[model samples]
Structure formats: structure tokens, C-alpha cells
Target: MKTGKRYSEAAKLIEKTKTYDLEEAVALVKKTASAKFDETIEAHFRLGVDGRHADQQVRGAVVLPHGTGKTVKVLVFAKGNKVDEALAAGADYAGGDELVPKIQNEGWLDFDVVVATPDMMGVVGRLGRVLGPKGLMPNPKAGTVTMDVTKAINDIKAGKIEYRLDKSNIIHVPIGKASFTEEQLTDNFQTLIDAVVKAKPAAAKGQYIKSLVVASTMGPGVKLNVTKY
Candidate 1:
């Protein structure tokens, strides 16, 4: 696919606007979204890094300001005390070994995220074939595997979106839909950007945030001027 000049321009702004506060950043982002563009704006985050560097690993979650514009079914892997916590925290599916067979047999990926407690990895482990290919595996490096069942479940229900750098060392995440107001999208966009920036590993060097673009589904990407942040 050909990357447009708009994408490159938006990327420049993303680099420039990195230092702005949430309030100021949102205001500027709104302006970018409202401006006339040569293409439609699909909401996506693009980050570039050198995947060869282990320290370049990027992981974290962010609650989109306007949600993901799609329903997210949350699946939690937990046992013992954490099971109740996960359920009470709003997990759609929270169980043990029994879920393994069901998930594997069904090969389900109806849920957008999978969270597992430290002890529950064993259960989730068996279903890797089912979930791994779908990108739903709960890996600790991605903050999906944790002992805090309640926090994990709640965050997912609250629209927490997680992303990791691909083989190309680029991470892309959806923040909202084209129908969302610019203000709402901007808020969600900034929140995710901040989280990703902070997730940079201390061992990582060079430019952690190579570029950023905010666009819509099947739309042209708008580069964010991020110098202020």
C-alpha cells in the first residue's frame, strides 16, 4: 500500500505534539481531525521501532475515550480466589481447565482480549493453539498475565486496548470509529499515546516513538503534531 503525504504530514505533527498536556493536546488533535483531508480518517496508531532490539518491546493498555466503537467480550482465566474477583470485576468468561477444552474445540475468538492470573497460565497454556493465532494469548510481557484479577478484568470491561510491536517493530491500535466526535476520539487517542510512550523499556534507545497517525476505517491518516506533549 502506498503511504500518502497526509500520513507523512500527520506523522510530523505526532512527533511535534508529543510534549503537550492532555487538554492542549486534545484541542490540537480536534483541529487536525476537523481539517479537510484528501482521504477519510480511520482511527489507528502507528509506532515504529527496531524489533531486533529486545528492549524495543512495547506493551501497555489504554481506555479509549469513546470506547472502541465495537463491543468487546472479555475472557478471563482464573482459579481459586481470583475466579470470583474476575467475575465480579466483569469478565465474560472466567473459569479453569474446563474452559480449555471448550475454547479449543470451539476455536472461539469472540472476545477482544484474554486476561489470566499467574496461576491460570496453565489453563491458558493448553489453549494457545486456539488463542495464539487469534492474538488473544495473555502474555505477561503484554500485561495480560497478572495476579491482579480484578484490575485486569475491570480494565478490559472499561475499554482497555493493548498492542505490541509487530515483526516490523510497528504497533497499531484502534481508538474509535469514524462516527465518534473529534473530541471523544482525541481524548482516547491521547490516552493511548501517553500509555505507549511510557511503556518504553529503560533499556531501549534511539527514538522510541518513530511516528504516529490517526485515521479512520478505510480513511486517510492524519498526522498529529506532538511537540507539545
Candidate 2:
């Protein structure tokens, strides 16, 4: 994994051994993002809890005040008036059984987030194998599976993002783009941290947030001090 000269230069700006405040880390991340395109700034959380334990699992969603920079394409799994309701609510693609084959056999996956009505779960269940592996499966915990299609669609359109722990117990999520102002990035970053901290499972003992890091798509990781978290 050889980094380009620009990436190497960007890496120089980050101190490998020092932990920074959230704002300072975000500033460095923006400065180090020298890519021609607007780089996505991602926040990586290394949690002390073990993902293997059911009680310790952490998963939820939040709508960023400033919103994630990218546009979100939503696909709703519903039927009857719900399908029409989903479309009217701004779902990019809305339907029932028809979407199953398109995603399974045709491999048609031209959407970012997937939302399904409670009753439509039966149809959505058919694509479990296809969607599960890709993390596209709608879940109640994330508000992707609900009876209120309009609210779901509106929240997603307004920059709602899901955060869940990976197998390593780390949660990786995009806070904003490098083009975002430091204040905006800091606001988004703090909002995400507050949500995660609040969602902490009682089963999770010891240090909850082991490490926090923020980095640009093509830049080196800048560590954030967890003491204040």
C-alpha cells in the first residue's frame, strides 16, 4: 500500500505519538487533505467493549445538524399505499416484491440506504442473503424499519447516518467532507460523539471509548484525546 507523494507530505503534518483535541484533529485533517477532489473526513472510534457480547453491542443512527456532505439515495421496501407514500416522501426507489429480484438476480443495487415498512419486512426478508453482507438490511434499531415512512425518508434526506460496531469493536463513520469548515466539522464530530457516548451499553465496563481518530479519505490518521470524551 504505497502512498502518493501528496499523501506522504500530508502524513508529515500529523504527529504520530500525540493525541489532539477534537477541533485540532479536524483542522489537521482538513489541512492534510490535498486530494484534487473533496475528500471525505471520517471518524474512527476504537471502543473498549467487545462486539462479541450481545449485551455490549452498540448500534444506532443520528441526523447530523450540518448533514453529511454527500447526497443519499434511499430505497424503500413497501407495498400498497405505503409504496406510494414512500415515493411521495422522497424515496429514490420504492416497491415491494419487484425489488427482490432486481437486487438478487439482476444485482441491481443503485441506492445508498434501504428503508422498509414494518409489514414489508416479509418481502425484504427474501433479500437477506444479498443485503445482509452489504449492511443494507433495514433494522428497527436504526429507524430504517418503521411504520412512519415519511419521517424515515425525511430524516435520511437530512443527513441521518447509522453507526454500528464492526467485528473489531470499532465504529467508522464519515463526519463530513474536507471542504467543510472546521466549525461545521467540529459540530458534526461532537454530535456523533455525544450520541455514541449516550448509547453506551451498561454492560460495557472500563474505558468505553478506547481511542478516537479522525482522518481524510487520503490522509494520515490524527488521533484525538479520549480524556475529554
Candidate 3:
């Protein structure tokens, strides 16, 4: 892979072997974000758990204190009054029978998040094969599947995010944009770290959080001292 000039310069600024404190890492990430566009800042976590074990799975949702800088496009699966409620609550697209077919036949997926009312799960279930892989499937645990379509849509629009472990036992989540104030980014980072820590499975042994790295979209990864969190 060929490296860009800006990325090479940014990488030079970070000590490859040094693990920084939470605040120091956050500051460095912000300082190194030299993209012309406001790049998104993300935190990647390597957890000590077997993702294959159902009980050891680390998955849940949290609302960032400062919210993700990007606007979320929400799609709601519902019918009747709930459909109107979803749209009124700012859902980008809301429907039921029509939606399932459009996605099933046309393969249309233009939304970021998917919210489905409980009653419509049966219909939504058919699209699991498509949405699941994209992490857009509405799950009860993530609060994306519920009776209150309005609240679900509003919460998603307000920066509620779901984090789940990947096959490699790593979780990558965006905390905020590079343009966010250091204080705002730190607050969001702490809120997510607290949620991940509290969600530790009893079956998880040894160090629950193995490693953590914070980085901007185009900047080099800044390793953080997990103990500092």
C-alpha cells in the first residue's frame, strides 16, 4: 500500500512503541488529523474473549455524551400509525410491506441505521441475511427493535450507537469528529469506555480489555494505555 505524504508526516509524529495516557492520546489524535475534511475519530478495542462463545460476546449500545458529529440517516420498519410516528420523529424512510420488498428485490440500502417495531420483526427477519452483515439489522439489545418507533428513531438521531465484537474479538467505534473540542471528544471516549467496561462478561477471564487505540480517519493510530481508562 502506498502512503500519502500527509499520512507519512502524521505517522512520524507518533512514537510507534509508546503507549500514551487517555488525555494525551486524545490530544495527539486531534493534533495529527490534517485532512481537508473533518475526519471522524474512532476508537478500536481489542478484547480478551472468544467471540465464538455466545456468553462471552461483548455487544451493547450507548449514547455518546457529545454525540457523533455526523448526522444519522434512519430507516424505520413499521405500519399504520407507527409509520407516521416514525416519519414525524425524523425517520429518513418509514414503511413496512413496501420496504421489505424494495430491499429484498431491488436491494436498496440507502440508510445508515434500521429501526423496526416489534410487531414488524417477522417481516424484517427476512432481510437479516442482507442487513446483518452490514451491522444495520435492528436488534432488541441495541434498542433498534422496540414498540416505540419514535423513541428509537430519535435516540439514533441523537447519537446512540451500537458496538459489537468482530470475528477477531475487536470492536471499532467512532467517538466523534476531529473537529470536536478535546473536552467533548474525551467525554465521549470516557462514556464509551465505561459502557464497555461495565459490559464485561462473567465468563471473560484475565484482562477484559486487551488493548485500545484512538485515531482519526486519515491519521496514524495512537495507542493508549488501557490502565489509564
Structural similarity to truth (TM-score) of each candidate: 0.74, 0.98, 0.97
> lDDT of candidate 1 vs native?
0.67
Q: Which tens-of-lDDT digit does each residue in 1-229 have in candidate 3?
A: 4348888898988999999998899999999999889999999999999989999999999999889998999999998999999999999999988888789889899999999999999999999999989999899989999988878877888888899999999999999999999999999999999999998999999988889999999899999998854
Q: Write the per-residue lDDT of candidate 1 for residues 1-229, one digit (tens) a residue.
A: 3346545554455544244444444444444453353222333444455657777667666766567666778888878878788888888878788787677787656677888888888878888777877788898766789988787776676777877777777777877655566677667777777887788778766656655655544333445544443
User: RMSD, each candidate, Å?
Assistant: 5.9, 1.2, 1.3
Model 1 residue 81 CA deviation (Å) reads 4.8
TM-score of 2: 0.98
Number of residue pairs clashing in candidate 3, backbone atoms closer than 3 angstroms, sequence gap of 3 or more or interchain: 0
- For candidate 1, the TM-score is 0.74
Candidate lDDT (C-alpha), each: 0.67, 0.93, 0.92
Better of 1 and 3 by lDDT: 3
Error of 3 at 202 (Å): 0.8
What is the C-alpha lDDT profile of model 2 across 126-154, one tens digit per residue?
89998998999999999999989999999
As a whole number from 0 to 100, the lDDT of residue 99 in candidate 3 is: 84
